[model samples]
Target: MCPPEHFEVSYSINPWMEPDKPTDAPLALVQWDRLRARLVSLGHRVDVVPPRPGLPDMVFAANAATVIDGRVLAARYRHPQRSGEEPAYQAWFAEHGYPVRQAGFVNEGEGDMLPTGARILAGTGFRTDHRAHAEAADHFGLPVVTLHLVDPYFYHLDTALAVLDHEEIMYYPGAFSPDSQALLRELYPDAILADEADAAVFGLNAISDGEHVLLPQSAVHLTESLRAAGFTPIAVDLSELLKAGGAAKCCALELRESLPSTERRREPS
Candidate 1:
């Protein structure tokens, strides 16, 4: 995990960012510490990637890459603001001895790609280019389920949808195109739908370890729904980080797959 020591809105690219808005640096550090402590306390190991001075968005590590079966498909960001982050993350993976494959197409790593057990769910239409989907398919040898995101607020697939275990999926329909929404309905008929109020707070941008779900504290409706669905929902207040357009799941989590036993224990927590 990286600290938000240099996090600030120097420029605006998405709806959540504004050049005039200032981030609470101290509070962001405290919040990040709490998240790390919470994850560690939950029997998960935590690792640190030293934060760089100018790359403020390094705290949101999920945007770094999409790793599966020990192969790293490093990100190629669309926006120039985040383009500088690619090398740092790629270097991290390479130093750890992972095979890092440089991506030719534009993609934002886990921000647009998520492996939902059976198939890979990929998002397009905003930050990630559609050609990246084909690249992902070729790289991973997995069938890619392309879901087009329509709303500017839900810029990434991770923001619009949350994979609950292998079969169950939760998402906000309004963020997706009509055909994508219909595709989702057909794909996961028993999927949980989040209302606009909950979705607005990024309720669907949650992380789960099969049973326990760590979500935004303000998303009470989603918390209760998760409880009813037999999943444990842990509320974490990441409001300070949210000011920069992300929350607990987006900032702290990086999902990888099929690592050697040693690297698996050290890399993912």
Candidate 2:
């Protein structure tokens, strides 16, 4: 995760960003620090990337790259404002001893590509290009399932859907195209569906450690649904970061390593 030291709504890249509105940079940092603390308390190791000037969106580190089996597929951002973030992320990954592969197409790293236990759930019709799916498939050596996002509010797949476990997920179906929604239903018949209220608060932008789910505190109904599904939900306040179109999942990037017993494990908490 990258610190929100320089984070601000200086430019509008997504629907959530409002450049005219007031943004509390100090409060954003406090909230981000709390989030990192919460994740560490849950037995997760948090890594920090130094924040660079003129790259406010760098705080949303999940958009930097997609790491699976120790291979890093560095991002090629669609928006010029975020384009500067790619090199910093690539340098960090390379310095950390991870093999970094630059993407041939426009792909927003983990923002558009999400890994399930069996295959990759890739998002398009927004920041990521449709052709990037094949690139991700070849790079990770895994099947890629493409899902189209219809709602501008849920531009990234992580904003509308979150992997709860190896085979389970929770999502807001309205954010996806009808065909994509049908595909999701076919793939996860028992998936938890979130209402518009919860989804409006970016409730689907969550991270799970198989048992514990960390998400926004304002998603009241989604919180109950998680409990009903026998998962522990840890509510956190990231209201300040919400102004910049990010919360728990957006600030954190999961670096997945292949294990001897399994090809790939689910994303970390």
Candidate 3:
């Protein structure tokens, strides 16, 4: 995750960004630090990427790349405001010894592509191009299920839907198109459905390590639902980052790769 040292709402990229409104940069950093601490406390190793000037949105590190099985498919941003972040992320991945491939089409990394155990759930209609889905499929050798987004508020798929595990998920049905919603139901019949109130607070922008689900504290109903589903819900305050259309999932990117059994069993402090 990248620090929110340069985070600000100086320009409007999404519906949530209001440039005219006041934003607390120091508070954003504090909230981001707390989030990193929480992840570490949960036995997860947190990696930091140095923040660069003139790239405020770099704090949303999840949009930097999509890593699957040690291969990196770097993001090709649709908006020019975020384009500069691509090189930094690509360089980071390359320097870290991950094979990085530049995207041939406009794709916002994890923002539009969500990898599951079997296939990739890709979103289009706002930031990501539908053609990028095929590129991702060919690159990862996994089937890509295209889902169309209809709501401007939920521009990225991560904002409306989150993968719970290999076979489970939770989402806001209203954010997707009718066909997409139907397809989601057909695929994940037992998925948790969030109400409009919870969704409005970006409740679906969560991270679940199969057992623990971390999300925003304002999503009261989602917390109860998560507990009912036998999952531990860790509520965190990310209201400062929410002003820029992000939360926990936005700031963190999962780097999926094969590891030795011994290394995998080692808990991180």
Candidate 2 lDDT over 3-34, as tens digits, reads: 98998899998999999999999999999999
Tens digit per residue, CA lDDT, model 1, 103-194: 88998888889877667899998998999999998999889999999999999998999887765779999999999999999999978889
Clashes of 3: 0
lDDT (tens digit, per residue) of candidate 3 on 1-269: 99999989999989999999999989999999999998999999998999999999999999998999999999999999999999998888888999999999999999989988778999999999999999999999989999999999999999999987776789999999999999999999989999999999989999888778899999999998888887889998899999999988999999989312221121212
Q: Better model by TM-score, 1 or 3?
A: 3
User: For candidate 1, what is the TM-score?
Assistant: 0.93
Which regions in candidate 1 have their CA more than 4 angstroms from the true location? 259-269
Weakest ten-residue segment in model 1 by summed lDDT: 260-269
Question: Could you list the CA RMSD of all candidates, in the order they appear?
Answer: 4.6, 3.0, 3.8
Worst 10 residues of 2 by lDDT: 259-268
lDDT of each: 0.83, 0.91, 0.91
| TM-score computed on alpha carbons, candidate 3 | 0.95
Q: Cα miss at 57, model 1 (Å)?
A: 0.9
